[model samples]
Target: MEHRVVLVTGGSSGIGKSIGIYLKSKGFKVYGTTRRLDSHPNFTDFELLELDVRNPESIGFAIARLMEREGRLDVLINNAGIGITGPIEETPHSEILKAFDTNFNGPIHMSKAVLPHMRRQEKGLIINITSIAGYMGLPYRGFYSASKGALELVTEALRMEVKGFGVNITNLAPGDFATNIASGRYHAPILSDSPYKEPYGNTLKMMNEHVDSGKDPMLVAQMVFKIINTKNPKVHYKVGEFMQKFSLFLKKILPDKVYEKLLMNHYKL
Candidate 1:
């Protein structure tokens, strides 16, 4: 029996890399994507391919190359995304657009590129790595949350659309993970004289500190493997510490204003 082929976007480092390696250990033939082949990190087990999710041509090319060789893409992990931090009012329009492009639109593009093949196979899984922020807005990270929320909605709609083809899809929302995402994160320029600078700086500081102390990326990888082993996956899976994952549950049950106050209070706003 042949091992199923898995493709993970943004696999050079962080969660993507962890998922790729973990899946490989489980006997899956995994291929991870980096924006540039030359920039791929020192990954030993799985193969690497060049893929820039923001570019449709690149997405198409990457999937095409994989299809040409594997003849089947059993699983696609849309794990590539970027983080931008700053006040919504102060963030550059271009920066916000870029966030949506890479986070939301990129997954859509990749999904579209791979769907036809998955449809042909009549069995496939697409796991999208979203964030807990998608459930509610976060200060200084509004656009990131917005982008993730948008993609979650897309996943919800797409799942209904693709069920007939035997394609399984789910949005995996991670609370926080100790990863290189902060180092590669895009920070908007905070002018010294800007009114929002003080709060923005404080919020950004808190956010990074939270992530620094967050759950291990391997935990998420393990969750991904579990999801794969299941015959029928859920529409959403939240992986992280109790509070982080439970907050979403709270939001669902609490009144809007109460939840808003709780969220604001937690962030020290």
Candidate 2:
């Protein structure tokens, strides 16, 4: 059997890197993309391509390179994303747009680039790495949530549109797996004299703690492997601590205000 080729965006480190390495271990040909190849001097887990998801030309060139080498691409993990947190009042519009570009728009463009290739092959899988937070609006991370939430909806639409071509699309919403996402996220500096300073500060600290104590990214990678092998996979999947996954269930059943209050209590706002 020929090795199934995989392309993972943002594969330089953390979750993307884990997915790439694990898939390679399973005998798949893995190509991971990083904006700068020189950034990680010791990264030799798999082939790293230079591509920024925000730039269409970059995305195209990288895929072209992969196609030239591998001849066929079988899986695309839209795992490249950035985290952003700030009070909506203080977060710069430019920064908000940047988050959308990488987190939301990046996946859409990557999928568009791959769909043509997949359609020709008549078999492919696209798993989007969304966040559980995308299911609800978190206080300081509203923009981040919105961007990811948008991806979830788009995945639903894109899945139906491409199923006839033997292409599968799904969203995997991970609650919080220990990774470097916190470091790369855009955090609005808490203003000392601002009205939201106190609450925002506390929430920010709590958010970091959650990431620090979060589960391993390998778990996410394992789930990715499972999704790849499953035939007729579902449209939405969640992987995380039980309570985090349960929170979504609660939101569906609880009254709107009740859920909102629960969130406020969770964040200690």
lDDT of 2 by residue, 1-269 (tens): 99999999999998999999999999999999999988878988999999999999999999998998988899999999999999999999999999999999999999988899999999999999999999999999999999999999999999999999999999999998899989998899999889999999999999999999999998999999999999988999999999999999999999999999999999988
Candidate 1 runs further than 4 Å off = none
- Shift in Å, residue 163, candidate 2: 0.6
Q: Residue-wise lDDT of candidate 1 within 1-269, one digit each (tens)?
A: 99999999998899999999999999999999998886645667689999999999998888889999999999999999999998888899999999999999999999999999999999999999999989899888999999999999999999999999999999999989999889888899878999987888888889899889988899999999999998999999999989988898898899999999987787777
- Report how far residue 106 has shifted in candidate 1, in Å: 0.6
Model 1 TM-score, 2 decimals: 0.97
User: Which regions of candidate 2 are displaced past 4 Å?
Assistant: none
Per-candidate clashes, comma-separated: 0, 0
* Deviation from truth (RMSD, Å), model 1: 1.1
Q: What is the C-alpha RMSD of each candidate to the true structure, in Å?
A: 1.1, 0.7
